[model samples]
Target: MKIFENCHLFHYPFEKVSAAHWQKYPNEYATHVVAVDTLDRKVLPDSQTLYTERLITCRQGVPRWILKLVDGAQECYIREVSYMDLKSRTLTLLSSNMTFCDRLRVHETVTYSPHHELNATVFRQEARIEALACMKRLANIVEQWSVDRISQKASIGKLGFENVLKQINLSVFHQLPVPSPDANS
Candidate 1:
């Protein structure tokens, strides 16, 4: 298994960062994400936390060598679960690949927390990739490809989120409608 981790400091408060998340989709940088469907959503009994489950469909490039070995489609599906706690002022997202799970799997976790000193938010991300193919070389190639794809997506997702954060009008956050998750481009 291959693992990756990254940390980013967003120069915005946790409240803003969390609020911006509702509208991060359909951004220019996230072209690979095709569709996102909300599978379930609920608030805990106390109403201090919100839980959500979503299915994300994304299409990305697969290396020719890997494609020759495994006949799979480029489009992939992912299951994402998110939790936001108002009392703790924390947000966590966990995602896993649903497609091609027999041969390869990627599990990622991202958390956002408030910074102690500043009104900023700290973002931490970790990803674990496993290639379960019998061939060693194929496994290596698949893991590497998955790692690279994750890295690229991480950067793109960050940029897209930053843009969303900048555009959020805190006073009228409830009025703005979130764009459709469907990516026509």
Candidate 2:
């Protein structure tokens, strides 16, 4: 088993950051994420929290040797669940791989909360890799590689969220406007 963790500050308030997260993916920084499908989404009975489930398909960027081990398929599916609390200004996400479960399992959890001091939003991510290989050595290698890959993905996701935030006017989220491609132009 291997573990990965990351924490970062987004220069936006919790509401803006949470909205950007919901609108994340299908953006410029997420080329690796090929497709996203919503399985379920609904506002909780209390009307303050939203629960969502989505399946995202991404292109795997592993070594050639690893690809060989994965039947040479370049894509994988991940199941994600998210809870967004409007009153508390918090968002929690949990995700795990749907494919390659027997040989490798990657589970990730993320939280977004307000940063009082910075007046921004703090993002925290943690991931664990379980590689059930016959040989201990191979399992260790795969686990390490999975951690490295997840770390890289987290960085990309941050950039993607930042880009999305830049495109929108943070004051309003209900409109769900698309960021202008020519904002700088």
- Whole-model lDDT per candidate: 0.87, 0.87
Please write out the lDDT profile of model 1 over residues 1-185, one tens digit for every residue: 99988899999999989988867787898988899899999998967889999999988777777665557588889999999988899999999999878778889999999999998999999999999856566788678777887888889889999988877855467787778778555
Worst 10 residues of 1 by lDDT: 63-72
Q: Per-residue lDDT for 34 in model 2?
A: 90
Candidate 1 colliding pairs: none
Candidate 2 accuracy as TM-score: 0.86
Q: What's the lDDT for residue 31 in model 2?
A: 90
lDDT tens digits by residue: candidate 2, 128-166: 899886536689888888888778878887888888988
| lDDT assessment of candidate 2 | 0.87
Give the Å error, residue 160, model 1: 1.2
- Per-candidate TM equals 0.86, 0.86
